[model samples]
Target: MPEVQRIVFAGTPDFAARPLQQLLDAGVRPVAVYTQPDRPAGRGRQASASPVKQTAVAAGLPVFQPPHFRDQTSLDELQALQPDLMIVVAYGLLLPTAVLTTPRLGCINVHASLLPRWRGAAPIQRALEAGDTESGVTLMQMDAGLDTGPMIAERRLPLPATMTGGELHDALAELGAQLLLETLPDIEQKLAAARPQPDTGVTYAHKLSKQEGQLDWQQSAQALANRVRAFNPWPVCWFEWQGKPVRVWSAQADSAEATRPGTVRRSDERLYIATGDGWLELLQVQPAGKKAMPVADWLRGSGQALQSGEVLT
Candidate 1:
């Protein structure tokens, strides 16, 4: 395999940033870095650079932020780079065919799923929500269709029954970086042997929405528990309590006597909520405008006392 020259990296978030850093550490600096334009973020809503842009700036690499490639000038700017290879990871923008073919070796992507499955946005969270036995990263040769590319290489990690979305995300990010470094040495050979994805198991993981976090007590306890774990550290799963939304950070499903779904039940100091199939034990929670705390702590704090049979609609 010939050595890759003039690699151009395109990514935006921390997941993408890790692999970029690893590449630099391995003495393979890209000619240029492409990231999404700074966008308003945080409670202050200030325009902030993406994690990838920050890494590039700190390393003194030239950075480019184009709103999109719809304009001819954007395409022209990239064409000028004459990249031998383009490594795209979570860049959050669709690349036109012109951009895809601009690189001599064509573009490749680091996607956070097994591929042929969970082929769209929000793969990490979707995998957790679906309770898949395993999840992994796939490096693919990019195509115009969404995440529909021939596979170059892949790395898998088993999903623990208790793993939350945040935990799985961190694990996959590191795994992806390691996979990229391993593949770079043999990338040319791997690309030549790339295999097309199977069509029978295709599944799309739609982007998450805040509304999806609203806990539905009518669902089985195991399903609700999965939802809570998947949505944590983002749109945390919540349910109405005393005219306010109380976010559940951690929970577990337990077998129990049947009761009306959404009914609050207390056993000694522990807190449990009735679900369609069983009981969901609330391990950690955050009251509105309050820091997350254990259910025991929340029970002892200054808040309205939860009645034994009070419904948490």
Candidate 2:
């Protein structure tokens, strides 16, 4: 077999594409790129390539889209590449032991969380929902277990109280790319000195579902506001208004008092709704079949007749 100087990249989304692009731009080109197969999306349901696939194609790298690696052929094909190392970032598939051991230098994963915490699917959303004050990326030496690997390096970012999930995702993606570039030069030494994650503070971020968007007015105002921040850009928090769903894009909790939960409360040109505790100010909203607009603009137009003391739920 040829000397194992080749790197193999496996990732699927835009978050993963950033690191791959960094690798290419730094002249550390992968011999083969592996991404998930095209899947249906949008109103037409037409097949669409993942962001990582697009990046690999534009860079003129060979691409692979095996459905799974359970079959021997997939393992054989991967082994044939004679890769020195493999880098995985949100590849969406679990790697079997066979494939993990194929690379001469093994595999490394650029996980979005600080490791041990938010160890599964929706780390960004989970962190936001839990109101974590900090977030970061972990460069891990891949193991058979789920994100339970030795950490080679980590980079932390302060989580602002008002930061939305989409904003944090973008910030971490860029930070992960920069850290990956910096770590590549001393990867061997870093892997050797990697430390084990503590058993405490372990948490799992389960994948979110569309049903999670349904807003419950009975919850605490702060809790509801966190959900709105967590679920933005996907499965957005919403409430039924006049038989149509109205997406809540941005909101905040205040100390205003109201008679009951879901009761609309106003203070000096601002709109707030009572929850189990305090009130939630609706900053931005998007009604079905309408673009997102400020609460004031939406109120002036569609919300002209709606008055305070009215209930949202």
Candidate 3:
């Protein structure tokens, strides 16, 4: 009989892939992996591989891409595996109470944020959007409520003011993987205890909305920069240039004095837009479905000239 833990891992995205890979590298081959079914993607609407699915496949492990967890037959299959414990990381599906209790050691979760703080879908982005000073991964015991579980471990990370959502996502992913690796021995020994989430403060990191990417120049420059960082690599921050939409990849709050919010202020070969608080300098941008280019390159190709007093909205 194999002495390694009989584990079932559940997750779907890149954030989940890190821990899955770590477990495999540590020679803790999961008994099975359950991820979200592949979904139609791209212009052709082809079924695309999920990050977790790809990692599971690369590791030569059994992969289950189920659409739902409610079917008793599917539940029975998981139970038959007799998993010692289930490790779930952003699996996207809610594990029914029955399945949660089925595992011999119950389930452990690797949440991206310190629990009871930023608990929900988009913790990393939410932290950047809120201008949070720090964020971390919380290892928790699964419960019925959304991330309303007792924490087994936690590791904090300081938030950088200039970091984009994508960067923070990568950072948390690595941190989460390490935290999970650290918590495993205790989990096997049944020495881990579930501590209730604090009741004093609770905030939900709601899922990202596509509309949030639509840049509103009326907002403050700092606020707009936050939006640019928060929505990156998803619903990218964008606004119209000569009636054409351009996505802004990177930018900084312009340190100059402001006149009217949204007015274009060109400073030292850079494009700046006045906002309620200050000005913002456009660093990287894509012109209406074209490749994202540095702000300087976009300047050379434009027909209409960017000038002060022209509102960017």
Local accuracy of candidate 3 as per-residue lDDT tens digits, 134-185: 9999998898999998888899999888988999999999999998888786
Number of the top candidate by TM-score? Answer: 1
Instruction: After superposing candidate 3 on the true structure, give the runs of residues whose Cα lies further than 4 Å from its correct spot.
Output: 1-4, 188-192
Candidate 1 lDDT, 1-313, residue by residue in tens = 4578889999999999999999999998999999999999999999999999999999999999999999999999999998989999999999999999999899999999999889998999999899898999999999999999999999999999889988988899999999999998878888999999998889999999999999888998999999899887877899877789889999999987759998888854688889999999999999988999888888887343886898877
lDDT of 2: 0.90
lDDT of 2 by residue, 201-291 (tens): 9999999998998878788888888999999888899988788888999999886664688887664456888898888889999988999
Clashing residue pairs in candidate 2, if any? none
Which residue pairs in candidate 3 have backbone atoms (N, alpha carbon, C) closer than 3 angstroms, thus clashing?
Answer: 254-279
Q: Output the better candidate (2/3) by lDDT.
A: 2
After superposition, candidate 2 runs with Cα above 4 Å error: 1-4, 267-269
Number of the top lDDT candidate:
1
Q: What is the Cα-based lDDT of residue 173 in candidate 2?
A: 94
**If ranked by lDDT, best first, what sequence of candidates would result?**
1, 2, 3
- Ordered by TM-score, highest first, the candidates read 1, 2, 3
